[model samples]
Target: MRDLHSNRPLVWSLFAAFALVTLYMLGVRTLVPPDEGRYAEMAREMFVTGDWVTTRLNGIKYFEKPPLQTWMNALSFSLFGVGEWQARLWTGLCGIGGVFITAYAGSRVFGQRVGLYAGLVLGSCFYWVACSQIDSLDMGLSGMMTIVLCALLLGQREGASARENRNWMLLCWAAMALSVLSKGLIGLMLPGGILVSYTLLTLQWRLWTRLHLVKGLLLFLAVAAPWFILVGLRNPEQPAFFFIHEHWDRFFKTEHHREQVWYVFFVLTAVGMVPWLGMLAQSLWLGAKRAPGVDPRAFRPRLMALVWAVFIIAFFTKSNSKLPGYILPVFPALALLTAIYLDAGSRLARVISAALTALVGAALLATVPFMPGMAGRSTEVALYQGYQPWVLVAGFVSLVGGALALLYARQMKRDLFVLVLAVTGFATTQIMIAGFEPIGKARAGTAMLPAIEAQLAPGTPIYAVGVYEQSMTFYLRRTVTLVAYTDEFSFGLQQQPELAIPTVPQFVERWMADAAAGRRNLAFMREDIYTALQAQGVPLRVVARDARRMVVANDVKQK
Candidate 1:
């Protein structure tokens, strides 16, 4: 209440610094397995195949999730030329945009100081920064949800001009639609659920009349429904698999192999906050003690934000589906709440922030030796050992930075204290990502592409037996024939049965046919599968070998 507005220059300067790290530096890294590689290759395939309506992974109908992210990435590839950076541009932009959106809305709801600090909290949060540059759907979803959260905050202000209210609510509705496109109905449903809980807590049903439900619903359907309808028309099974199976089943059942203990989300939030975690907890404690808004009877934006954060954590706690990134929607609200508390210059918060910063430094330093444990295989441990030096450097820098932040906190230099931790955390995270190349090397099929390319003869059928690598098709620039292997693409293969060989015997017969014709063929398989094929007299010569997989070809005369 006492001149807590941000100094524009300071806010802009810090924000600019954060952008430089998130955009250019983070963009330079390799895409990791499963998610990053999968999504990047999807966009790549989208660009190459020019079949945007029916999403395909390795040329199979991939209807597991919606395609807004892929569409954006595909467009990015068109303009920038496909590379790791171009592939990740959407998520980076979203993270950068999320900061500005939170700042703008936080200032409107609380004060400029809260706005600036909230941006810092989110910008420095590991989850926000890490996911932002990774080319994941969650970053896009979190970005859109941040907008919706901001719009809800501004639109729900105790007193606002009718036009302002209408515009804000419309933006909120439109964001929900965008979220649906970004991920699924949870985009709309998550926000809607939070709103219902907020209304119940605040006893503020009056805001509903002003929500323009009819117009908003029409707008949402107009923006989000067309894709659903069109995709369903084009692929009949998609409607059931997507709406019922993907959304609900993925959440309620352990179909994705992602089930974890209910407390897993709590762990994510704790680690996700990192240097800011202590400050956030202290802020939340203080914020909860009083009405978190302009008036006692008026709605508490902080409580709403707190409720927003808690609802998300509690919402998925019991659900069988879980991932570290799913809890990200709550960060913006928590950032706002933390910012408001910090703006009051809570002395204990500064002390705790200082102590926590030191603890983070110690933890990071301790993490150096454990780096090898992150590697999947014994051979990869040496590669992970090579990464240890970078981790050590980041740890040392963070230890020093944490000490400095502790000093700044003691001096009550709020800005510098926050800035120090933010920069250190950002650097440490970037270091870890940069050092992950060795691991990515083992996981990505990228290097194998070149070796496989050198051996290819024209019309030489390439088969992936007992494995489906999502990134292989993108890197190879063509889909490999799936021989008895369809993991995530099982549903897609069901719709287009010709795309797969369902059994080992079937693949053996096909390979023999190709071999007898004196036509060379390529195959990639897990080591065990390759061994089994060899035992079955399928006749394969090793072309390339990695710790987890091998590339081979039919025993044939070299050209």
Candidate 2:
């Protein structure tokens, strides 16, 4: 394989292409339900209320996770305005930047081509690409973990200057600190645990001295502990909720109601890595093979990476709680392994990878025709109809890229083969993901916002009766009163009792009082809730309706 380092243009091109695909998708789709809208709203509230200490959801105390992501997101809003793309910019940048960082660290540790391949594998990996395009803490968490892992690898290299070693170790500690800020303590726990286990496995007690524990610990404490300390001080209940309930209880008990079968992550990581899973296994097997080495004290980067991946999967698997993103920290290590494997220039590996690409391309193409049939709802099917052409474009790009990869492998052009698949990754992400805008639109409840907004005059209190559309709170640019509806926000609402209207009767009484006081009120609820409201003979008039939600107003004349 030709050295990718010689061609600055090619490197820049890859970065540009990946960035464009990821950034373009940020604005194309409305923030989807639950996660996207939830995080974005959290950031929005932080920006609105100027309360960076205790993170809030729907104007209530939200203490499940730390505020690092929310802080970055709030910073984004301050810089770019309160738009979708702006909210996502931090996560998108982290994903793109993580690719380069992994490549840089890989090159420093391995060689140039291996580094390029590392970036290619990570940037284009199915799950990484998907995570990068969304506004989630996972990518941020993944990126930060990559930094910490890479720094540890780079610092522990065989023969670096003492100054260089200390600097790298310090950076590693700092990145771990930021990692804590990114998601929660797992950021430190996962990687730190990996380091301890790897050290024990290698029997390299001397590696401990290289860690620069004194300054590193101080640096980590300085960056990571402040927010927790401050937020806990401000909201006394938060320390218990975040440290105990969120981390410990979430791991030990399924009290949060997110328990899953033990093998879920195994399946998710296997499917998530997709075309690269075979290479990942191959890399691991290769790592486990003992090389003929006289120096038993030698440090092993692959061993470190393998430990990182294994520890994350094992720790998460042992926990009572699980999510798809919990396994994201494993990809960096897998990408590193694949890069090393690719660096060895295995024609057979390239051939197999290309074949997998072809299979995946075919599968993507195959899904296009049946998309409408797949969706049970007409609105969703209509979204599929509108989104079908772009899916075909994605399929065509992926197919062509795969076919080109096969030809490159046939001709022994491994560089072109990898490059083709990489571009296909970028294209698949851009087309297929951005193409889901219609679906996002449908689920986003944006269509119903206009009518809902019209009925909402200045200072008109809006009620989310028996339903909470996440994006609506952000769209309305104010917190909606929850009338007998608190799902995820129940914890926060519990902490702040005044923030919600906990019962249907309470809402009715409040609505009647507000109506009698000559204050117009509007409500958005599910169709079932609207039916129930009608059956109860609620005075609200239906102003607008969508497939799932209805907007009702006290004054029919406004509609």
Candidate 3:
């Protein structure tokens, strides 16, 4: 019940420990496909190729995303060799930085206590924490979007000096630029839409007058325009594919096959905001209403946050393409609202939230025994079994933390109660994600790295026939020839047809020619494809293989 600000040492120590564990967990698990492996490989190729402007995946020109994440990842690789942690350094920093910025903005807009609570809420949310350690664009984009949100809140709050206003607004502009580079037009589109929604709902038309639109537009264009210009100039086909196909077509068409029912993100948000689920509905409802005696024309930070969250969720919900990560930008807004609500909420509300946490923990414990059943492949049974103990530990941690939270809430120690729940949420998510290493290992095929390395020769042909493990190309420090395999790479292959063989017959002809010339060749294919090739008397000697993939080499003698 003491002033939390007075306990500075405890607060700093808790944050320090959380940060250390998060950094340690960066390298704790293998990079899983298709996002983790795909992004990492793209960065690796950029770093190795020294072609920063043009992003490539497995040596094919890939224009699906802007190169901000790839540029950052490649910079990480240049500084510290290519590895799991290096590949993830940008996203990890973004995640951690998002927490600090949101907390600082909360303090300025609300209060110190509210800021502290906001940071805790965001840092522990399951979706935010899990994405932070993964090598993907979602965390990078979310982190930048967090900057745009926080900077706007700080810049637009009441009683700000002109100098303070301009600086924060500029920072918001720059972050939006980076956000555009991180994912695409959504960076600017999302913020622009949120601001419009907030103005219409709150009638804060004067907000546009103070946004420094002229200066902000200049800064945004400066940061975001060069890459689009240069990449488009160099690759003429990039502009249409990236702008129309990647953004417009992706949003309106279900060709990406990511379509889901309208309520999918509603389900994701409910599950993603664990331990705070009981507080979500109330916080959002409270966020829409202005507090007593606030100026009608003055900025409503809470309402802005509410509008920000709702607009983003609704934007993606209307899209024909829906992925869970698409809705990640809303978490910071949700965190701010939840933090404000909890700081002033009743003890009964706190008790109910804590009770829900404990109940969820118990449910997790009950499901621990059924993990093996979740595996679709026989090879995955042991991997899921290996994950059980971790689930057990996480469940117990959540259960005990929730019990302690209940005790603290009853004693009117709100700070301790929230801290316990935050730590519990963060710890449980980290443990479960780290526990996925066994399954990640199978998908990564990193165990085959050693055998594949031993067979490498300068300029030797390596083909990916019927399948391509994105991570394998990065781990092997080389690109693979694509043979009848172009899923996401279809556009890239169309841009550079010479980069791929185009069909199985072409690959087979090349393989036979290489054998006749006594040259070496290697291929990676699905087990079934390998079996079918063997039935056709293809000359392949198994070099290394696992349950799902096979690495085979030509049986011809090397000259």
Candidate 4:
């Protein structure tokens, strides 16, 4: 056990293996819709259009999010040809980088063992690992917020030199700026709120003096302001929509239709922690308590982490709109606190955590047979059936790993217990995420890409009739005209009215005119819409189809 903990080469090899797996997993799963496909398509448009100043999705102005993620993904596409992995490259790197940063911060503030465990905890966390592989704004935002967090901890910890404090605090501020760029105002607001809560709770008023406020604020603006300025200059409508509608309206009102019960985040926290659930409550409780012999006014990273997790969770819970990913930034803090607790906690707690993992695994194993029953459509039955084997493997691996970890804990093999649990958690998450490929493949509409591509020319008019498959835009390398559909694209459609046919009749009229002109017209629409159009005597020839959607052409003859 001692040798395992102290062996530098083995430790580094584990880190390298974990990193390689994380990067490899980026390409393993197809980009799933609303978030993953939305961002990928946005970046593809940016790369193709060469419009770095303004961000657009589906050839319409999209100001709901700041463009840091888009910019990064677009840059990824530029460097490497556009692909699923390329779209997700930034979020993956951010996730890996966050693990290293947290480890370094934990080593500095807590101890070497705590640092090692902290990295393992975060790197293997089900939620963190899962989000890392999925290309979404939350992971990107969380990654930058992780920097904002660790940098502050490094800067404010006791016994820091003046130069070290200054440099770290500067990094903290700049990261906050990047955080804002990744999401929106919550980037600055959440961290600032957490800091205030920490100060009020711990009475760490003197901590502010070391923040280098003047220099830090300047550095922040320098990194975060130019994009806002250039983008706002180019599109005057962005400022109002982004700052007011995106932030205030989304938070204060239920306009996005994402509201949920108050206990949702709490539930997510419990589930997201997975094998570590046994240690979570105790860790948070202990985190709020000051260590014995520590100075009353000294900087406390544990308390800071507690406040960071609590404040962000509470802040979002108060918002009328909520999502599973909103509380992602809290994972690093939780991992740190959990690591500290495991390093110094009771043997009973360790055993219980390991046992809980085994129980969860067993539970998952029992549910494998019921997976096919959960599918709504008959066609989805095969996908769910294909996924069952993967879940069975994951469950067995977790069950074995957890039992081994429990045995290690009972035998006082502390290092082995942690390593086994970490690897189990990571492997289980990767397995489940990769196992989702069959379902994701259907959702992404990638299977129809070859058929769809064969029907396209340089300027073939493609209409997204009553629906949009977010991934198709990127795969087809072209934008579709919105027909009688405007969910998230409402604002963008408002800006470019000419980009859409707002009503079914209008779309049908346009299709008739295009057919008369002998122009190739392709469309993607729901099965019901296809039926309705067929009933209306529209000249629609099915090019390709899945259970949920269909692709059709205006006429039989190719233009």
Candidate 5:
């Protein structure tokens, strides 16, 4: 009872620390990244237009992904008003929820120490930190996947009491259905694929009989199928494009034309697991040697985690279109595994922890000179900028923490590892926030929206000459018309030669014809194109010229 009481505070402290870190990371940034902006804009558009059926970017059909994330964003916008932070709030909340759920699951599978460690590892993982702060669908899917997986694992532990496990199974189905809603088929496919493979590989057939497969399938379909079916009926073109072209063909035939060699994922995976890679390796190595049936419950959970990690890695590795975030679901599994390994107090675990701490120290030290522009700077620039001084300070703190942790471990300590991991994670989180300063300060193209908006009359007929800026379209909340010259440039000469402007004489004739009809013509052109029009003596005046775009209007007053 005394031991239990002592453990309670430590566990609560770990939870509190992780929660603070997650909140700090989430609170620091505006949605400046590519996908976040796109999603937020889409949601805002949806809310304003009240058209949830089809998604439009720049007022054109954008059927690239399903509507779940958009719907979530729209709902958020409705509740919180349309803003960058509000758009990203749900993802952040999901991320925090994932950390807690993973910890709870870990506690059930192993013990309190393992659970605390798992939560710490997960909350601090660079992948989770970065991905969770954004407005992407991947993190949502990842969170849902973690919850479903934990529920399933916990249900499996109920053992022989079908009634008790039923609720867990039902939760799994519901979570999985949410996953599918979050990111399409892979939510169901990846988890189902991994579980089946693990069961077969480990000869755990009895687990299958316990799963109540029929009821679970019905639940999944009941929850997930409606949206797909409704969306399919509404937009007949989507099913072929999404399931076949995006999923199957993109993987098998390189339809999206993103083919990388298999070893690329190994590099990506290493980078993705940063700061925890050493611990992960040690966990897998130690886990591989555990004799069968020593603790059947422990053995199964670890086995499931291993299979989860392997299956996600393997599945994405075999795909033609590989992205860094594709394997995010594997992080929770790795965290659980690492937590379990850390709890054992093995010499190997301590060595792994020490090595990882050293690497993190080096990394933090390296960031000292670069923090100012580091977040916004390209990778090459960040590296060339060297470490920032404050980053160095953070590094020194982490280094001291890590060294003390190693010393504590040598003396058979546990909490020090958690402390070091938390400190390092906090430092890394700060570094990431510092890195965003330059990007936030840098003038994103959205800055020009007000200028562009001011220039337009109630219906001045806006048109792009040789470019289509999605950011402009998103912020402006209206589609800019695409003129021949601009369309050619945006689509490129090879794919859209028809968009090329005819000769000067031909352009003048067309301009005069439009002018004769009293049409107020405005064309956004490149400076070179504007110069060419002036050279051709087609009476046009520059309305505005930025570094990248030049707005031109026909000189009706001169006429």
Candidate 6:
């Protein structure tokens, strides 16, 4: 095999591409569709309180997820201050790291040409781009797992010395621990299942002999177990409920997120791969035919990659609950396969690449005019909100990028094509951040914070009548009390019955009592609840209203 670093220019080009994608995604404003605002606010809470043990939303106990992501956000906040950009910095860095790791791993396993292709594909992937920009835990987990898998693959193939192998094993365990910190048990579950299945299927069981399994397990347990234990000890119900119901039960039951059949991931996979979908399919087919003849000792990395792709798809497909992001970890393997397939440099490969570039370019071009209107609906801002200039800029950049990609494809210049895609993606993302997002922020629940504030007197108790918006909480800088009007809907009311105020009768009694005492009460209610109150003849005056929420103040003059 050629010396991977001998092609320094190509490697640098790949790095530049990765950097471009990272910057674009990171530069964009925290968008809707994935609850970026909620995650960002939680991080703000973490930074504000400095308490690492328990997670809070709007200053209320929020245990929906573990603390690792919030910790990363808090660290960024401490250094960069609280805002959308700072909140997403860590996720962006992890995304860039994932791209490089994929490239490096490919180079080691399949040579430099393949590594460069792999990096390009991963960097330009739409799903990767979207996930990288958001303040979600999945991207970080996917990136860490990719690095660990690559390290282990390289170790298994090249580590002749015990010390070398041990070092790799330790790195793998560390990555696993970090994955656990990112999203809980599924982190360890997906990677561990893939490795175990690959080892058994490839008859590389003896390789486990070199893994120092006991030490690796101990290390993982030491790092990951303490947090779970402490969190569980602090909240006793968490141990059984989170591990059992949220993890196991949620996987097998549709109680959390139910959708379609098990094989629905095929659609997700295709969509996630986007422009590279055709190439990914070809790569997987090529891998299946060639994987068996490769030496188990020498070609184990490819087999491991296959296992990673297959196991994740299988595991998630079988789960009763599924989301688009759940299949993210499998992408690195698909990327590697696509890179190998593209490395042949055949006329057909170039054509496929050209097609992909054109498709993405077309998609971007089509999105421009609609972008501002789309922003208006999500943000409830006027359709002409200051996003037109940015949208035009993004459109122009996409045209340039598409043209560059076509030029490179015609010239058979793979590196240049990669660079063009990266540049375009970055430019489009920047337009979104600087252009489209301000409109979104103006319409997002965050926009209502000032109005809510104006209505409240100094230290007036604000309450979320039946719903909570994490973004609203962050902006308000205090926890809004939750008043449940129904047993079916009130949050935190089941465990703490004292907080439950079931039925309009209950709500009326509380409001009347508080008002009678000359105390002002402001309630944030969802549209449905406000309507329900109206239907019940509660005489609730709507001080403010929006698509999803309403603010009602009893005795409006009191404030």
What RMSD, rounded to one decimal, does every model reach?
A: 2.1, 1.7, 1.3, 1.1, 5.0, 3.8
Give the per-residue lDDT digits (tens) of candidate 4, residues 1-559: 6656467898899989999999998998788887899999999999988999899999999988999999999999999989999999999999999999998999899988999999999998889999999889999999999999999999999999999999999999999999999998898999889989989998879998999999999999999999999998988999999999999999999989999999899999888888788899899999989999999989989999999999988998999999999999999999999999989998888899899989878988999999999888998999999999999999998999999999999988888889999999999999999999989989888898889888888989999988988888877888899998999999988889998889999989989998888887999988888898889888898999997788999976655
* CA lDDT scores, all candidates in order: 0.82, 0.83, 0.90, 0.91, 0.70, 0.71
User: Which candidate number has the best TM-score?
Assistant: 4
| Residue-level error in angstroms, candidate 1, position 444 | 0.7
Candidate 5 on 1-559: residue-level lDDT in tens? 2232147776677567666666566555555635766777778888888988777554555666767788888998899787666777778778889888888888877777677778878887778877888888889889899988898888887442667688888889888989888888888898889889987777777877767789999999998888778867876766776787667876788646667778776777676665667666778765556544566433277778888888899988988888777888888888888888777747656756666776677777876654555444353354324335545765776677667767766766566656576567656656755555434423235545565666566676666665555445555666565555432123223333444453445555666677677665666676777788787777676665554556666754633
Show model 3 residue runs off by greater than 4 Å: 556-559
Can you write out model 3's per-residue Cα lDDT over 1-559, one digit (the tens) per residue? 3566447787677778877888888998888888888999999999988999999999999999999999999999999999999989998899888988998899889998899899899999988998898988889999999999999999999998999889999999999999999999999999999999898888879899879999999999999999999998999999999999999999999998999999999899988888788899889998988888998888999999999899999999999999989888889999999999988878887888888888878988999999999997887799899999999999998888888898998998998898888998999899889888988989888889888888888888899999998888888888999999899999999889999998887898899888777788999987877788789988888889887688988864433
- Residue-level error in angstroms, candidate 3, position 125: 0.8
Local accuracy of candidate 1 as per-residue lDDT tens digits, 216-325: 89989999999889988988888988888888888788878998987999999988887677777776675566553456667677777888888889988977888888
Answer with 4 or 5, whichever has the higher TM-score.
4
**Looking at candidate 4, what is the lDDT of residue 463?**
92
Clashes of 4: 0
Q: Which pairs clash (backbone N, Cα, C closer than 3 Å) in model 1? A: none
Residue 105, candidate 2: alpha-carbon lDDT: 89
Clashing pairs in 3: none
Report the Cα lDDT for candidate 5.
0.70
Give the CA lDDT, 0 to 100, for residue 16 in model 1: 85
Off by over 4 Å in 5: 1-17, 20-27, 158-160, 289-299, 367-401, 440-443, 456-468, 477-479, 482-559
TM-score of candidate 4 against the unseen true structure? 0.98
TM-score comparison, 1 vs 2, better candidate: 2
TM-score computed on alpha carbons, candidate 3: 0.98
